[model samples]
Target: MSQAAGGVGKRIAKGSMWLSAARLVVNLSGMVSTVLLARLLVPADFGLVAIAATLMQIVTSITEMSLSQALIRLDDPTDQDFHSAWTLSMLRGVTIAVVLSASAPLVAHIYGDQRLVPIMIVLGCGAALSGLANPWLAVFQRKLVFWQEFVLSTASKMTNVIVAVAVAWYFQSYWAIVAGIVGMYAATVIASYCILPRLPRFSLASWRTLLSFSVWTSASQLVNALNWRADQLLVGKIATPTVLGYYNVGFNLANLATRETTLPLIQTLFPAFAAIKHDKPRLAAAYIRADRLLVALGVPVGVGFALVAQPMVPLFLNPKWLPAVPIIQAFAVIFGLQGIAGLVTPLGMAMGQVRLLFMRDLQVLCIRLPLMIAGAVIWGVPGLVAARVLTGLYQIAIAMLLAKRLAGVSLMRQLRTHLPTLISCCAMALAVWWVAGTGWRLFAGYDLAQDLVLRVMVGGIVYIGARVILWIVMGRPEGLEREAANMVGKLRRRPA
Candidate 1:
């Protein structure tokens, strides 16, 4: 590797670690908060809030300018660039707040729940506060300096957890979730300014420059949001609040395994890819390496979570949430497999292929919305879950094709890259299933918590063992195994 490539890799690695640590803290706290809220409130409470949240997301997505992304993409963004991004963000936020608040009554009527009116209005205010965050924060991302982001995310999420839990305990209402959402956004805006210490000026001097790049990005965001949330919206409309609540919580739990694992890498990849976009060879190599690592790390967690869902759901969430078990089990593996194409968006963005991304999202939405609607109408939640799995698989193929087109990495080669992780995960899953299925028969009197712990332990051991054996059998190729060894070496060599 060239000195520049090596330097970029180091920065990317460091930034990823920081962001990953932040995600770790955030996910841990989030899980705790979810557990507390689940115990304190009924599924109906979550269902009611999920309806309002989905509408809020749809509104925000439609108006997304992606100014922060544009600012990050710029080689040398000036103060005017930052100011313009901030101004556009503020404008977008205000627009979303107004639209959401205005549509509250209609949304309530559509969902047949008057409670949505207040929840939607409160969430709209949160959206506006989100726009007030410092645009200069993009500078840290541009430079791959993520410690400040770490601080900002951790503080905000911790605040959310504390406030949500307190409110849930005291009020025992769905409003607790709404309060947490608003509190997180408010905390983010406050923390952003404190970390960056920037007094953002309102300006339009560079609006054209920012928006020119962001228009396609905004379209992509809108489509992507719809692609993910359409099912939830349909469920909210067709199903009861209690059922929607079950689906929402289950989907989120499934997401935790995949999103928490791959998202940190995805968050860092855009700036990292952009930094080296001029070097095609290095970029291609980096893309493949990152893709492999994501799959290798994410797949086991996802599949393992699915493997243990039977026991895990009952243990952490209690029997009341057992209805969510199938949802978690089905989606966990699907989301994990999604890591195969997880980096596609960042790759496209870095290659200045936002138009292609928008097109891709549009294509998926066309396929997904119809399937989602049919599934929901025909089979209810189970049908919807099955439809999502099918669509998710289709998306993986689309992402692979896009990756091949942009990076010239063939589909076969990409599949090969994922082969080792796939094999190891399969091994891990089989071992865990055996323990849960057959071994549990051998070991009598095992409670839900014990079964969950045993399965997790067995799965982790099997995955690591299989991975190592595969690496050796494959001649210790340059991939995640090597990367892990190198990181370990560096850590060991450091002063105590």
Candidate 2:
């Protein structure tokens, strides 16, 4: 490898480390807050918020320009680019605020719930605040040095959790959920300017340049959001608010693992890929490695969570949330598959193939919207979630084609990378099942809490044991042995 390639590799490694640390901090706080809120509040509270949140997401996504990505893709960005992007953002924010404010009452009336009116309006303001955040943050991603991004993202998450918990304790209503949502964006906008120390000017000198790049991305974002939020939309529309809340709980819990683990790595890849987009060999290599890495991490967590859902649910959540247990199990596998498939979007974008990305999402949206709605109408929340698994398969197939066309990464190569990880995870699941069944038979008197803790411990040990054996059998592919050996060498050389 050239010195340049080595340097990029080092930067990617460092950036990933920082992002992982940031996700750890954020997810810990989020989990604690979720536990407290779930105990103190009820499903209806969450459902009420989801009603307004769904609308706000649609509006924001429909209008999003993805200016940050455009900026990041540029090899050399200028001050005018920043100013123009900020200008576009300001206009977009105002538009979202106005549109959301206007549509709030209609949405509330449609749902026959007047409470959503104020919540929708408030969420609009939050979206606007998000629009005002510093564009300089993109520079961090562009350079693959995300220390400031870490600080900004972590501070916002911490602030969000703290405020939400305090509010929920006081109000015991959906207002706590609102507070968290708004607080996170406000915190991000404040920290963005402070950390980057940039005063964005209102200008449109680079408008044409940015729009040319972001137009397709904007379409993709809109369709992507529709597909992403289709289930929530369907649930919120057909089911009772309380039912929607239960579904939301399951969805959120399942998604939390993906967001914290697979998402951080995927987010880092866009710029990393862009840096080497012109080099097909290097880009393909990185893509394969990343695919293997995400599968190795995601499969175990998904399968483990699915295995222990029954015990874990009653222990961590209130009994009222027991309805979400099955939903959680279904989505655990879905999210695991999604983590592997979701890589195609950023990779496509980095290769300047946003049009392909947009088309893929559009195809899914056409099929997914009707499918989710029918499922919800026919079988309720569980059906809606099951519908998603089918859609996920469709997406994975499309992603495989995109990988082949854009990166020359064949499906066989992809399967080769994922095969060992998949096999090891299956072994781990079997081990966990055996352990849990044996423990249940022996300790008939154990409560859910004790059972959950024991099962989790046993699952972790089994999974690690299976992974180690597989690693040796697969010749320690994807650099696991090398990374471990390097760490050991560093430990030996340390002064301590």
Candidate 3:
């Protein structure tokens, strides 16, 4: 490996470590908020909010221009670039807010839920606040200074949870959720400005440069969001708010597996990839290394979640949410497939191949959107999830093919590299399933929560032990063991 490649690898590893810590806190806090709101607010409340939230997502995506991404990709972005991006972002936010507010009644009518009107308005304002967030935050991302992002992001999530819990406890309505979102965005925007403390000029001087990059990036983002969220969008229209709420919970829970594991990796890689885009060898190496780590971590998390869902649902959630158990299990598998596929977009952007990313997303949308609609209409909730699982598999195939073409790494090599992790995860899944399935049979006296905790502990141990032993057996396949030893060596060499 070149010195540059080694440096980038270490930076990514260190950055991911920091980001993982931050996202762990963020996810935990989010879970707390989800649990509190689930218990306090009814499923219908979540459903109503889901309706408005979906509309807001659609609006946000439609107006999304990824100027932060552009800034990161540019080798030497000037102040004018930042000013231009910020100005465009502000306009996008205001435009989305106005459009959402004006369309609130129509959106409510479409969903046959008038409660969405006010929620849409509130969420719209929140979206606008998000737009005004200082673009200088990308400066840290561009340089792989992720710890600051960790601080800012975690603070934002903590603020969201505190305000959300208090409002949900007091008001006991969907407004609590809406208000919490507003607070979270407000906090994030404030933190961004504090980080840089630079006022952006309201100018269009750099519009051409910014738009040249962002046009395709924004299109891909819009299509990608639509592709993934089409089920929720369609389900909200056909199903009751309560049903949509259940689906939302299930979907989010499933996402916990993939998103929590891969999110930091993805965020860390975009800038890293862009830095070495001209160096094909280094870029490909970084891409493969990242892929291996994601599969190693993500597959087990998704499988474990599926294995424990039966016990987890009853223990952590109220009985009213029982319907989401199967949905969560199915989506878990889907997200596992997506854990690797999610790399396609960022990789393309980093390679200055945004048009290819758009084409890939457009391909998925052409197939997946129709399937989602059919599934929602024909089989209802289960069908919706099943359709997504199918799409997930499709995305995997498409994304890997694209990876081979863009990165010059064959699909067979990619699959072979992940094979050990796949085998280990499968073994771990079986072990977890057996434990969760028959734990009560073997140890008949524990309460549901105790049983769940025991199963999780056993599952985690089995998974880790199996992964380590299998890797050693495979001759330390993927170099994970080597990486661990290297980390230990570095730590020991440091002053105690």
Candidate 4:
């Protein structure tokens, strides 16, 4: 690698480390909050919040101008640019809040649950507050200096968990969840200024420059949000709060394992990709390396979590959440497969292909919305899950094709890059399944916890063993394995 490439790699590694540490803290606190809230409040509490949150997301997506992305893409943004981005962002937030607040009664009527009106109104306020966050935060990301991001995210999430759990324990009402949502955004806005200490003026002097790049991005965001959240919205209307709660909890838990694992890296990849976008070969190489590492790490966690969902749900969340086990299992596996093309979005954005991305999202939404509606109408939640799994696979194919077009990486090469991790994950899944099925007979006193532990251990062992053997057989290929070795060597050689 050239010195320039190596420098980019170092920046990515350091940035990823900081962001990963933040995610680790956030996810752990989030899990604790989830468990505590699940016990203190019923599924209906979760269901009510989920419905309101989903609606807020849809409305927000519609108005999202991708100001941060626009700012990041600029080679050198001026004070005017930051002020314009902030002005637009604040306006978008207010728009979302007004739309959501005005639609609250209608949403409540559609769901036949009057409780959602207040929830939606409150969440809309939170959305508006989020707009006040420092627009200059994007500069840290653009420069690949993520420590501030780490502090901002961790502080906000910690505040959310602390406030939510305390409220749940005391109030024993769904208001606890609402309070947490508002608190998180408030913390975010406050932390953003505290960290950067910037006084952004309200101006649109650079509106044309910002909006020019964000037009297609906004379209893509709207479509992508609808594609992802339509099912939940539909479910909230068609099913009872309790049912929606189960589905919501299951879906979140399933995504938690995979999303939290890859999100830090994905966040870093945007700026990293942008740094090398002018050099197609370097950009492509970066994408491939990032995607491979993501798959290798994400696939095992997703699949392994699916394998253990049956025991995990009961052990961690109690029997009331058992119905969520299958949902968790199904979505976990689907998310795992989707990670194969996880870096495609960053690649496209880095390459200035927002129009292509918008088209891709529009196509998926066209196909996904119909299938999801049909599935929800026919078979309820299970049918919806099945439809999502199908669409998720389709999305993966579309993403891979997009990667090829944008980066000039072939479809064949993309598949081959993921083959080793895919195979290792498959082997691990099979081993765990077998151990949980017939192999349990060997232990005289096998329990749910024991089975879960045994499966995890076996899966970890089989996956590492298989991955190592494959790496060796492939002549120590220059990929995640090599990266791991290099990282280890660096750590060992560091001065004490």
The best candidate in terms of lDDT: 1
> Model 3 over residues 1-496: C-alpha lDDT tens digits?
5786678778877898899998899888888888888899988888777777777887788877889898888879998899899999999999989999999999878777788888888898999888888887888888788887787788799999999889999989889889888999999988887777887779888889989998888888789778867688787788888888899888888887666777888888888878877888867887887788787777878877887787777677788898988988898877876777767777888889999888988998998888888888899877878788898899899989998988887888888877776777777777767766665544556467766776678778887787678777767654676789789999999997
Greater TM-score among 1 and 4 belongs to 1
TM-score of 3: 0.95
| Candidate 2 off by > 4 Å | 441-446, 474-496
Better of 1 and 4 by lDDT: 1
Q: Write the per-residue lDDT of candidate 1 for residues 128-190, one digit (tens) a residue.
A: 989999998888888888999899989999999998999999999998999999999999999
lDDT of each: 0.89, 0.84, 0.82, 0.89
lDDT of 4 by residue, 175-197 (tens): 99999989999999999999999
Lowest summed lDDT over 10 consecutive residues: which window, candidate 2? 437-446
TM-score for candidate 4, please give it.
0.96
**lDDT value, candidate 1, whole model:** 0.89
- Candidate 1 Cα outliers beyond 4 Å, as residue runs: 439-446, 485-496
Model 1's TM-score against the true structure: 0.96
Quote each prediction's TM-score. Answer: 0.96, 0.95, 0.95, 0.96
Query: Per-residue lDDT for 273-306 in model 2, tens only?
Result: 8888999998898898888788777777777778
Number of the predicted model whose TM-score against the real structure is largest: 1
